[model samples]
Target: MDTPTEVLHRVFGYDSFRAGQQEIIEHVVAGGDALVLMPTGGGKSLCYQIPALVRPGVGVVVSPLIALMQDQVDALTALGVRAGFLNSTQDFAERQQVESAFLAGELDLLYLAPERLRVEATVRLLAKGEISVFAIDEAHCVSQWGHDFRPDYLALSELRELWPEVPRIALTATATPATHAEISSRLGLDGARHFVASFDRPNIQYRIAPKSEPKRQLLEFLRTEHQGDAGIVYCMSRASVEKIAAFLVDNGVDAVPYHAGLDSRTRAAHQAQFLREEGLVVVATIAFGMGIDKPDVRFVAHLDLPKSVEGYYQETGRAGRDGLPATAWMAYGLQDVVQQRKLLTEGDEAHRRRQALHLDAMLALCETVGCRRVMLLDYFGQQGSEPCGNCDTCQAPPESWDGTVPAQKVLSAVLRLKRERRQKFGVGQIVDILLGKQTAKVLQHGHESLTVFGVGTELGNAEWHGVVRQLLAQGLLAVEADYGALVLTDASGDVLRGQRQVPLRRDAPRPLRAKTAAAAKSRPAAELPQEAAPVFERLRAWRAATAKEQGVPAYVIFHDSTLREIATLAPSTLEELATVNGVGENKLAKYGEQVLEALTA
Candidate 1:
């Protein structure tokens, strides 16, 4: 029998385990239960996969996304692993074949959706076969308070009840301390050993820009920083997804729209295209990207704000999964704050409170003047991290000035409007009043004569809007649920009096589009030596054709990282090619000669 390290190199083409992987694998192989909190792209799959291969029976994987099961199986199959999935998408005959393989002990791993376990037939089917281990991927979904809660995951605790002897491992890419505890409790893994990996992804540079013609800003960001790269653009609404996708396509980008609103077939086709093709961008709502295994996504841009810091981290974590430099960018503004606040009003008191806490944490991250990475890590209960010079704040530190006077000016304007005029207004009117703009709305209200009007002319219209946004973020200003008009919070009293000093972050002038630290560290083929570029392109072309022929993603044949190593080494023999990191035995024996021919030609 092959050992785990040997199996790692022979099948998956890695020379050694990533940090914290070896110990976890050893324990699971020894029949111990574990809960793993590793970040995305941290080789969480290998922790369970190697143990499954070395153990006696098929590993039963409980996955959340049935739609992605085929791609997952395809990826493993390319490595010469006998992998099969039983999901609703498969026909009865297809399910029967996988079942037979499982029963015959011919399959290495069998993937199933969590809901499938509720079926009595599926339970009986599992009872008929031996299970080496149970891996619950995306285990954070079991947390009722988490961003992506799936009711089906709550039933996963029964796995331990049914198969008391089969060791289980639950894995997730994002979880806070609270969510971690909840996962343990809900999944009945409280006694299971826990391994929490560092949540930092230094390859991703975090950036948040104040929204200014956001679609245009997104387009400029794409064209300038991430041209000809695979990316995901997240929007809060389906309409925004469609409009942004169309806008990008119109502006000479190869982009597609993905949301729950699309038909299943259309969504699948778009997802397949994104995985198979290069330089494609998918503009999607939050529904699109939970289990995406694509590793080359260079950037994740948010056109609107995410509700929670955990959700934001989870979404941005999807980028730079290959450990190459990538970007986590967002366009945030006053309306995003208001919209999210309004959303919190729905649901029960407990639900509203939980969502409010989430929103508050997210707002704090957006408004933070320190390192975005540090704030992100702190939210996940990791501390003592020095400034990561890759985030926008660290790269270009913003000035924080005493905004107490400006705060008073803005608050006075709102106060006067309410107490004197018995009227309320949203941000636009408030900013106009602050700037002393004699717009029709102001004149119709009959008087630019308020004491606070024109007091804020020391700042530009944009600057006044920034003050309002910051005040809202700081909780001194609240949005009325009925009409989103500015209302004062209990915290507003201190600033209204002279008792509080409000220090606010000044929005820096937009910098020139130049190579950021993250961009400079990127190792794309474009950065390869001049001679190797063409060879890399040739290999990419060959791989594309082969993937099309085999009906699988190009990465399944070989990752771009592996090909880059091959292009750099210019290996002349199969022996030399096998030395590459991702060149496994199966791939070497299958495509070794063709790779050499492609390199030489």
Candidate 2:
């Protein structure tokens, strides 16, 4: 049996395990259960893949997404692992072949969707086979409260009951304390050893801007920050996904949309192109991005507010997976909060309250004046060190000014309008009254003779909006169910009485500094030296052609990161090339000669 370290290099082509990976692997290899909470691109796959390889029988991996299973099998096969997947996508004949292989014990890992496990036949087949560990990927899907809940995943807990002897490992890329606890309980892994890695992705620069003409802002950001790079643009709705995708394509960008509304074939084709092609942008809804394993995603831009900080982190974590410099940019505003609130109103009271809390956490992250990384990490029950210099706040610290007076004025306007005038208005109306705008609604409400009237004229409409958002985020204000009127919460009285001081981030779009811009434009290290550039391109061309011929994503042949390593090292012999990270035994054996020939050519 290959030790975990030996398998790490010989199969996965890594010199060492990432933090917490080795320990988790060892625990699983020793037939112990584990629950791993690592960030996206944090090598969560290896914790199971390696253990599966070292263990005796095939590791049964339960993934939630069919697309994910296909990609996982393809990548693992490329690494010389006998991996196969049985999902709805396969034909009857294909399914038979995989089943035969499984029964014959010719497979090391088998990826199955949770729905497949519900079938009695499938469960009985596994019972007859010599099973190894049971690995559940995206374990958070078991949490009914999570953003990406799948009913199919709920059926997975049966595995623990059916095969209690087989060790189980549940893994997820993002989970909060509550969600973490729920995952453990739901997956029947409550007693499993827990390994929680740092939630920070330091390579991803986090930036959130107040939404104003979001399309225009997104276009400018793409042109300036991510030109000729592969990325994802997340929109709140399918309509916006289609519109933005069309707009991007019209502007000479290679972009496509992916949403739940689209047919599965269309979604699959678009996703395949995104994985195989370089510099393609997929404008998508939250329906996308659960099991994406792309390593070189340069950025993830959110065109609207995510439901929660966990959702936001998972979506943005898709970028910089290769441990390269990347970006997490978002555009949000008061409207996002209102829209989310309206959405929650449709659910049951308990569900609505839970969603409201999640939204509040997300809003607080956006409205915070401090470091975004720190705020984001803190939400996930992790303590962050000094401000991460990679985020927008750390890059160009937002101007913070005393917002106490403005907050008081905003809250006073809300309270007076509700109590004395017997009127409840939206945030816009409140801001209009505060900014002294004598709009028709304000005029109809009678002369603005209130003490707070015109008192906030020192701030413009936009500035006042910022103050209101901050107050809402800080719990100083709340939106009453009565016509969505802003109401003063108990916390508001402290600020109104001068007992609390509010600090608001006066956020403005700071032009990308030349240094930052250059860093943003920096390519993978393999493309840096002039000599290696041509070689890197050559290797990419070869990989692309091979992938096209094989009908698999190019990354399956060799990830860009791996090709870059090969290019930089310029290994002239097969033996020398084998030493490059990501050059696993199977890939090296299959492509070593061709790789060396490309370098010489």
The TM-score of candidate 1 is 0.97
Q: Write the per-residue lDDT of candidate 1 for residues 376-445, one digit (tens) a residue.
A: 9988889999999888888788889999999998888888999999998998998888888899999999
| CA lDDT scores, all candidates in order | 0.91, 0.85
lDDT of 2 by residue, 234-316 (tens): 99899999999999999988899999999988999999989878789999998888888888899999988999888999899
Q: How far is each candidate from the true structure, as Cα RMSD in Å?
A: 1.9, 2.3
Q: What value does the lDDT take at residue 359 in candidate 1?
A: 92
The true-versus-predicted C-alpha distance at residue 553 of model 1, in Å, is: 0.8
TM agreement with the true structure for every prediction: 0.97, 0.94
